[model samples]
Target: MGISTDSTPRYTYQLPVAAAPSEPPSAAEGAAASLQDALLVGNLLWFVRLRWVAISALTAFGAAGLLVRGAFPPLGLRPPTGWPFLIAALLLLANFGYLGHARWIVRNPQHRGAAWNLWVQIVADLLALTVVVYFLGSLETAAPFMYLAHVVLACIFFPRWQSFVVVVVASGLYAACVIVERLEIVHTPGIYLDPLLRQAMTGHSAFPWVTASSALGIFFVVWFLASHLSSLVRQQERELADANVRLTIAQRDKTRHMLRTTHELKAPFAAIAANAQLLLRGNCGVLPGEAAEVVRRIAARCRRLAIEIQEMLQLANLQSADEQPKPLRLDLAEMVHWAIARVGAAAQARRVTVDADLAPAHVVAVEDHIKMLLTNIIANAVAYSYEGGTVRVRCHVAASDGPVITIEDEGIGIPADKLPRIFDEYYRTEEAVRHNKDSTGLGLAIVRHVAASLEIRVQVESAPNCGTRFTLRFPRAG
Candidate 1:
């Protein structure tokens, strides 16, 4: 509901920068502005419609009163039919004019002038209601309560101070009407009747003073409560917006720091792996058996470390990218086959069996991210499974839930307590660390991040020594 200012710069550079030109809004910015304007116009139109309803009801009530007076002369209670008709006609004319103005503002939102428009409408409504109350016996009848309705409306659409101003002005006008009627300055009929209940009573009495005082007291109390509640809600909304802005800033800073550190580490590890591989292959010279075996182990570990650094860099880039990858139509079955092929070597090394039940289904997603997500899940399953255990992968469309991809493995399953933190970066369970010492613990984290970017839902079910199942549900593309 609130708009944030983009005064904070996104990035800084050492190089000299050129002055940027003032340009038109981007598509996203324009769409957001258009949506805001549309909402404002809708609110204004709704207020205008409510006024039309109020005016119609007033006209109908006036006509009914005139009919009752004509039919029963013995009642002897004179109603102000002529003045009600005149007031209703004037109100209808003003409402029709304001409706036209509201439509014009909707068409020309740049010139809407909301504050002035609201003030004019509210003041006019208060005046019209005061006239109606006067005609309907003022403080004697329940028509004075109508001012409270206007007070509530003002509280909803106006600022707290402005609504209070409305309460003050309305109370003053109604109090003046009561005073004049009590003093015979205007000969309006009162609500009381004679002993026979057939004649109206003339009053210069204490009842009007008491009624006016009570009405004013009620008005102030209603205004105070409504204004205080509105202020609290606005304050909460502003606080939430500020918190979100701070979180976004902190995330961007963390991503930048990780990207720089990982880039520096990757190069040295790559050189170390290359030199160790040369020595192990006898490219430099033939060495003792023990020396060659040590070099072989060093080369293998370095290569694995390099791969882990590369994955970390990929994750950092995914987090920092401002624009998301656009989704494209792709075959789910083909993507699953690609992922199986990716983990074929790992599965073979573990002596694990791979099974797939794929149905021909198409979805919309970034092809590379989806393929990488599948590869990570399947590779993790292969890495964790026992020798000769089964790794099952399935893909198909559900009757009510769109397309789903599931990978299940009879692996050393995660502990119940560690399930919640499994997807956190560098979070490996104790059992997992014992089974595979070289595990970087970044596979599930990568899987989670990629799935989120592609709008896929991932659900996990596992028990210790009972195997684990990971299910991914994809939304249908129109």
Candidate 2:
């Protein structure tokens, strides 16, 4: 039996910052730990009463104790007059003591202790079995019970390989005991009961036949029980795994529903924002200076509101993507240039110096999805950056991966607490929401969803006042 010596280990989990990685324990280990704890709690009362060793130990000793007391001189029915029932009683008492020690070992689970206590119990059991076999005068009378206990111990405390080895050792002990008894090597008293061979049968020896039948029965019964227990454990493990899968599906469905609602709301608001911008640009004819400026501010706020709504919808769509990615070979360098060019006007308006370094390669990804991922990241960098600051967009080949893209901006960066959850839907940092009051906080969440579907990794590094860098690493084409 390999023992568990570590009380705890680090667990990994996925974080929300785009493709940030966090370590948490796998589902299987957690399920096993929960099952073990539940079983312990369910049997708490019984464990406390019997001191936590197997119930068989107590029952076996109790039965033998009753038999020993009943076969006393006062009963006046003892056929084996010279048999040492007292010795059998003493062996039963010793078993009780060993069980107490086993319980102690169970209660105190030492992560780095020797197996000294376990070895001691094994030796004590062996010695006790020897005494019983000698006192009973024959293997047919005493050795079967000892063999049964050995089998039980092996199943409870040992691995399959070790358990089988112990079973072989137990069978050998039985053979040795039987041989010694048959040869009359021991001179203790023996008990002989009548054998019902036929209708006219008289008293006949049945010890050999009975012992052989009992051993055969024990082998089959233990094997069946072990097989049944193993099946139960496997069935429960599968059920737990299925439940976790269902939970993930439900979470996605809820996120999708929210996104659809946001999209429905944004469609009308986008038209309203556009018309307002048109009027402010003199489409409705010229007006006084002060009135024109008021119209301009209203148009700007409406545009900001539209952007926030669009971001919310983006968050919902990112998490709700259920279909397989429609892959096609396309020039990724051109796509990057296209995205940067789309956002170029806005960056130039803010006096933000935008730079790009692109690599020539074909990438297989959905065109619209990649566009959204790139646009949001670049826009966020430009929006946060000060006038005349730099926003760098780089695309290159990674040594260990496929295409690697990074967008970095010189701007007031994210705080430590807010950085970890930057990709969560509707999650906005104080600084981000302050920069644009109507920020929808869905940009990074959409980025995560797209990367997850493509089996890509996204990472972010940022510190307050030190600017932020976002990295996207795509898997190579097959």
Top-scoring candidate (TM-score): 1
lDDT of each: 0.75, 0.62
User: Model 2, 208-237: lDDT tens per residue?
Assistant: 546655774675477447645655665676
TM-score of 2: 0.52
For model 1, how does the per-residue alpha-carbon lDDT over 1-478 read when each residue is reduced to its tens digit? 0111234221111111222211123433454456545655665667778887887787776776787666434555454457767777887887787778877877787775555666777788888887777766676577888889878877866669988999998898888777776666877554333323312332435656777889899999999999888778757855764554555566667777988998999889889888998897789999799999898888889978887987787777667645657889999999999999988988998888889999988888878878878988998888888888889999999988888998988888777677878877999999998887878988877777776666677778776666778888888866
Candidate 1 local lDDT, residue 360: 82
Q: Tell me the TM-score of each prediction against the true structure.
A: 0.70, 0.52
In model 1, where do residues sit more than 4 Å from their true spots? 1-137, 141-158, 172-210, 286-297, 415-420
TM-score quality measure for candidate 1: 0.70
Q: How many clashes in each structure? A: 0, 7
Give candidate 1's root-mean-square deviation (CA, Å). Answer: 11.2
Cα shift from native, residue 233, model 1 (Å): 3.8
